[model samples]
Target: MVSKPSSAASARTVSVLALVAAVLVGAFLAPVVYDAAAPTPDRVAVISVDGTITSYTADQLEEDLHEARENESIKAVVLQVDSPGGSAAASEQMYLAVNRTAQEMPVVSSVEGTGASGAYYTMLPSESIYVTPSSVIGSVGVRGSAPIGGSSNEIRTGPDKASMTLDHREAQIETLKHAFVGSVMEHRGDELSLSREEVAYAKVYTGARATQNGYADDIGTLQTAIDRAASEAGLENYEVVEKEPSTRSGIILLSSQNGNSTVVVEESPIGYDGVRAPQFLMVYGQVQYEDEVIGNVSA
Candidate 1:
């Protein structure tokens, strides 16, 4: 019942529909385009050292540290520690990795609960170390159980195959202890009020006491450490990226059967190539020894 629309009106209608479609598309894409144009924020990496430091833990931490070093977006690092420490070799590896990362950029440490022995060693390279008031720090020394001896009936190819001499074990322990103490002195000597002899005593210090004695820089939370790290990197607006240790079913630190002592089990089998080897620990808790453990056994 109506006349056909004019060609001119149809053209106008087509133009209007095209305009509306363009507007709708633009509205959807504007935010995306803006996001693409924006710069990425600088990042502060927070690497955690939880539970006992093992070979596996050390490797994971090293990977994180390496990532932070290689990534241009990452400006600084915060080592978040909540461990009683672990294997001597593993701890040393962690320390070396941390030290290398520190040389490249600012590295700060925050102790959440306990950072003792090897944990302390691992944080030595940090520019500043922070701890909570209740945090435990220090215990810078080494202890080891004597090697298990072969049975009298067992045959050995070499004199040292079955067991290392007591004197040799003692010497080895002394060497390890000296190196640990020396590293502590090298890093914290200027601030320390305690002497080398006192440090050799291997005492665990409360956070407050540690700060006063120069084992820790100040009493602060993990957030505080992150802020400090960002500040050190000259980042006013930065993002924090946390790298957590891999989860695995291994005994970390557990109370012994008697409930009075603690046993630190590393992720690596307690030995060399699956053989039950002597364990040299830079740990804070009381260690339980097996019958194979020689020397003055503690219960």
Candidate 2:
């Protein structure tokens, strides 16, 4: 027996066949499409540090460290440090953050070019420090600026303000310097036997010298540092999470005009010269000038 199909039925059959063909094609190309489109997960949060270590740098490190701690997938943190030095306060802040993060997760410091003074100080809190063979490290000291008196005549202040004399101020500055040196000694005494005098001197040293002096741990590249951190964190395959500056919680007010200014003026006396001609005749002359003129000229 032979059967003839209706036009509408034949059209429906063709549509079904086309749909099946499309489904097969999609299945065959699905892996290739996903492989090309999907982004590879990063395994480490790498922070690069260069130049002077400031509060901004410290804040950045702290933010990244906190992010790594919160992210379960983020295994380790690799701090790539290459800085000479900066403010002691800034370095201390960074050191505290790194230390706290190390307690929770593995944090490694890698010296790429140089890490001296404040730079080295920031690295001290890490679990283990890695430095390139040629990298410089280990100044490990503190420095600050003190207000030195210029001259008694030049120094002026409000009536209620206490005056600072040169000798007394110098003695106070010296005392502060001694106190700072003592603090450095306390922090680094166990790691390296550095006397207060040595720390106060603020000396620089090479990577090899740093390791020998117990300043740095190992001499290796940044990659080695990352690997070590990962190994210490016990993470074979993990994802890296970078915390952007904008995503930070606190508010940063960066405005130049936040205060007011006022000006004050004062008047003082001046000396005049008298000329005597021969023994019989004497001549004296006085010049009149406004206080504002004198103040403006002096200022």
Candidate 3:
């Protein structure tokens, strides 16, 4: 045991000490690196849906919803709706996206000024809906003209090819109505006191009436909605953040290659060319240039 240490044995001891030092350094710096790389996981995303809900608004809502889903920091979603509804197609798109996100996280819809028709439809997908005492909700109906039909002076084609017939138009109206009714039944079924016919009748209600009839969860503000969402999601501590969604415009092309091929393309904004087909919309507005109501299309 008193023999002099060999050079090889001394070199091995030095190498072992260096290895231990490296491990200690890594342990000390690991948390710093992780903290810098990862965002704080105490955030809730709030997306605003103000004014008329066109394709543009739908795209924005979709962007925020996706961000909330992909980002681990986001704990829940709150849809701040202040719309009088718009094109039914856009509302449907928003509904589907919100519903999908709700499946992954808690989503609460909070009404601001008005959430009627398609706007209400968009909110239906949330886990719960919140509205102030003054908030206006409901108007679950479609508003659009029947498809236009042209005479034989045009190109030779099928009878109902240019436009749907009277019967066909009626069927389509029924289809839209049934779709709205089906969604209402599915989303607000157990809590809904109103019948299928009553809802399809397209009646608007105040926040108090809406909550009384089970159309809305409760009468509260956006803050209330956020607090409730956090509590329901088991988030004892969190921060509410309003995320700015991308506003760039783009075209969405959908193509089908069946025997009767059909290609549909839509723009996210009002096109320069006034070319658009009649859309089944849940819009509730009076047409007017300044103050006077035009034809009073508030039906």
Candidate 4:
């Protein structure tokens, strides 16, 4: 016959089993408890594009976008835009910069006040464009002062030194317009309800109209855009780090009722350096005028 085990041995065994179970439960819950106690969120970078998009502004914004791309901590980017657009070449530069950044990570654009012409062009590569009810967008076109006749006594190295013919200027304008419209179609074609020709009309639409016409995404605030960008980056917990550009006084170029345009060279945001030259502009609103005005195109 076998002897029965002692009651003390059974009690000790039960205690050991209970201790093992407690340790298992603690191991499972430690990470959850630590996460809840000190939450560390991902980061989203906010870059602002205010005022006219001149070479100076484009340079600043491009640098910011480059930084966001290189920073491993920045999971996403939100472009805070509020501008009427400016210099065509500068705008193209911005477009390229934004496109490059978007390729690496998620990029979203938020139009605050007016995002027309070149400003619109810069945001083409964004995954989504958020705007407020009063925000404006569109104006997909190009403009420039027509080439003017050189002085009769002025010596010229070539036949087109001072200015080109009207036909040549028109051709240049058409080319730029085609490029702008084509970019719009390429980026938002699937969502747009308007035709290429209609886009060429260069009409500025309100936020609601822009959404309906596919020029913009759903109506949302700047914060909403930031949240959307974080979501797109697959970040449930995130923090926004705004990258503010250097501040400088700006010269406001206003167009009078009589169709006259005036530009102040001093501290001008357009970066013209006080010289008005005939150059293609992807911009909306009033224009700066020069003596040899071939044409002042606008919407």
Candidate 5:
């Protein structure tokens, strides 16, 4: 009958509709499942140093450097150093970390804004040093200071108090400076040929001058530094992993783990000429407050 033929046609149409619905559902989900199962691409580790060099910064760089060395897929490391300078000990630690890491992988130092004093020392061990045209690069020297109090000559029972003599303080500063000079000479003795006077004076130099004076290897931008690293490592195309965060607003407060205990005051509050006063003392490796008020608090 005509009804039978119409019923057969309707049944075929229902079957086709069901197939189309199933196909649509699969098409939507296939990509989602595939994406979830996909592997992440390997990336090179980028270390950025901005501001003064410190033990914390060195520790962070060491950690990342070790990670990159262990992961074979990581092609190279780019060190973006922008700093004025810092403690001699901190600079030495960072220099050692970079040298050790460079043995396993290509380490490139890219001087962006400023790399001076202790900051410049860190770049000596790198495979190649790159600097921007306008970047400030060299300040190849060392400095150390200790607080001297003019007002109080109170006799103390502890070894901590006994150790606070003028002679001892001067000796400590000299020792730190000597160590810094030694490190510089160990890495760049032939190139720099730095004398005692040069290291002691702490001279600042521009990027071009640094390159000319054998303080820097080449003058180039950040991208050029990256390209140089990649070329050295024989990487045709590698991903750049910028590990440093864009915003560093909160980083300033958290830089040094050690409390700001050493207070250096410029002018003598005790009306003493050519006398320095330490506001606080470090007793047995701990910060101890000094009650005696002395010089003008410049720091």
Candidate 6:
């Protein structure tokens, strides 16, 4: 019409219309109209192992582990530990419970302040262990008052019946150490980089040194431990739930199905003076000498 627009101009006009059409079509069908799918969240159960590991502490741990086991939401467990060790039997019970939990799902032992001796022993059952740089570890040994000599006032039936002789006591301790060492070796297996003698000496290793010596898998933070647990459990988005003891009752009360019940009360800051018999305790601390008076003032 104005010389009927040139063929080149006509082609350009059609190209512009086609471009606009494509843009308009794309806008109508854009994915931005829909929100992204929500990620499935998993649950991680954290149980504390603070202070000394007593029989009561072991009971709580068992209950916590059992609860976690029963909960379908819990994908893994993290033992947040800070203990200088405690009763050997209690530690063993906790270890057995942890081992059972591991068989079901991933379990991680994360050390905070100090996870030594019996506390460290409890770690053997975990799939992996993590500790902060300054955390204490090891002291793979036991210490308790060895019934020094038989009572002169008390009459006994046999030579060893009155009390465990010094020799037998020493031998018993060695037996206990052997068993402890065996458990450590069995659990750590080829991952153990330290020599048998090093382990036998019951030396504590720092986090970095522990990893180097294979006493620990890595030096990491609590979050790192949780993340490791999550990875082991194959979880992306996850929830962390801490299971604090529901009751602070310092009493052990039990009742049978037939209604026979019993309750044992304890003194706060409980004394470990062998009230439950001389304990084969896997504890670490300055040992009290016979000559020194306990709970003495510095002044």
Q: Give one digit per residue, the lDDT tens place, for model 6 in 1-299.
A: 36688999999999999999999988876755443454445799888987667788899999999999999889999999998877778888988899899999999989978889989988898888999889888888876555545677778787756656667767877887887888899899688987776798988878777887888898887788888889999999899999875445433221112221122233335653212345667766642222322132110
Lowest lDDT sum, 10 consecutive residues, model 4, at: 290-299
The segments of candidate 3 whose C-alpha lies over 4 angstroms from its true place after superposition are: 1-39, 245-272, 287-299
Q: Total clashing residue pairs per candidate?
A: 0, 1, 0, 2, 4, 1
Write the residue-wise lDDT of candidate 5 on 157-248 in tens digits. Answer: 77565646667666766676676667667666667745656755666667887777666788898888888888888878578888762332
Which pairs clash in the backbone of model 6? 1-4
Candidate 5 residue spans exceeding 4 A from truth: 1-42, 150-161, 193-200, 246-299
Q: Candidate 6, which segments miss by more than 4 Å at Cα?
A: 1-41, 151-153, 157-160, 245-276, 287-299
- lDDT agreement of model 5 with the native: 0.65
> Which pairs of residues have clashing backbones in candidate 4?
146-294, 146-295
Winner by TM-score between candidate 3 and candidate 1: 1
Question: Candidate 2: which stretches are off by over 4 Å?
Answer: 1-42, 150-201, 238-299
- Local distance difference test, candidate 1: 0.84
User: Among these predicted structures, which one has the highest lDDT?
Assistant: 1
Quantify all predictions' global Cα lDDT against the true fold: 0.84, 0.60, 0.77, 0.83, 0.65, 0.77
In model 2, pairs of residues that clash are: 42-240
Model 4, runs deviating above 4 Å: 1-41, 150-154, 159-162, 249-273, 287-299
TM-score of each: 0.80, 0.59, 0.75, 0.75, 0.65, 0.72
Ranking by lDDT: 1, 4, 3, 6, 5, 2
Query: Could you tell me the TM-score of candidate 2?
Result: 0.59
Error of 4 at 17 (Å): 39
Q: Alpha-carbon error at 172 in model 2, in Å?
A: 8.6
Q: Write the per-residue lDDT of candidate 4 for residues 133-249, one digit (tens) a residue.
A: 888899999877655575577788987675466788789889888988999999999999999899999999999889999999999999988998989999987789999777645
